[model samples]
Target: VLVGRDIGTVVIPEAPIKFYIDAAPEERARRRYHELKKQGKHVPYEQVLADILRRDRIDSERDLSPLRAAEDAVRIDNTGQSAAETLAQALAILRAKFG
Candidate 1:
């Protein structure tokens, strides 16, 4: 199974490969809002954005197992990329490395 965030640095540290995906705060919040809306979750955008920022800070600044991109991880910034586009990029990388 694919893990996220602190996967490489903490959980499954011995995994053969790892990736770090991130987006701008505003963009992430917007995406999250839309996703939740589609699910009928009526949470406010401001609240979601605030929570996202808060979680980011806490995860990044935590003393133990802080959320960090491992030195060997392939980083992907999906700020403007669609889900299909992002998946294609990842698949391309995987095929190039494994095939």
Candidate 2:
């Protein structure tokens, strides 16, 4: 289920799997910082961190579009995991469900 500020509350059939991908605020900040740097855009790490924190606060505290995971949604913490590891875990979940 794709729930966001742009998505309204509408019930839809055939909703089998729903996953909300998330990362730590600091980790996101760091990734954003590096991506910007790679593009030759100069931005301070502190600024990136602040921007990420601000986004988190707004997302969590929003009245109409607050960010939250569904009760039955599986939470995956990719904080310290590599991309390959995360992908493997997600694939494993799918295999278990379908196989």
Highest TM-score scorer: 1
> Model 1 over residues 1-99: C-alpha lDDT tens digits?
576777887887777778888899999999999999999999999999999999999999999888899888889999999989999999998899888
**Candidate topping lDDT:** 1
TM-scores of the models, in the order given: 0.89, 0.79
lDDT of 2 by residue, 1-99 (tens): 365532322242234655555789788888889999999999999999999899888987988657666555556788767779877987888788888
Name the TM-score of candidate 2.
Answer: 0.79
Model 1 C-alpha lDDT versus the unseen true structure: 0.90
Residue pairs that clash (backbone atoms under 3 angstroms), model 1:
none
**lDDT, candidate 2, at 21:** 56
The worst-scoring run of ten residues by lDDT in candidate 2 lies at: 5-14
**Pairs that collide, model 2:** none
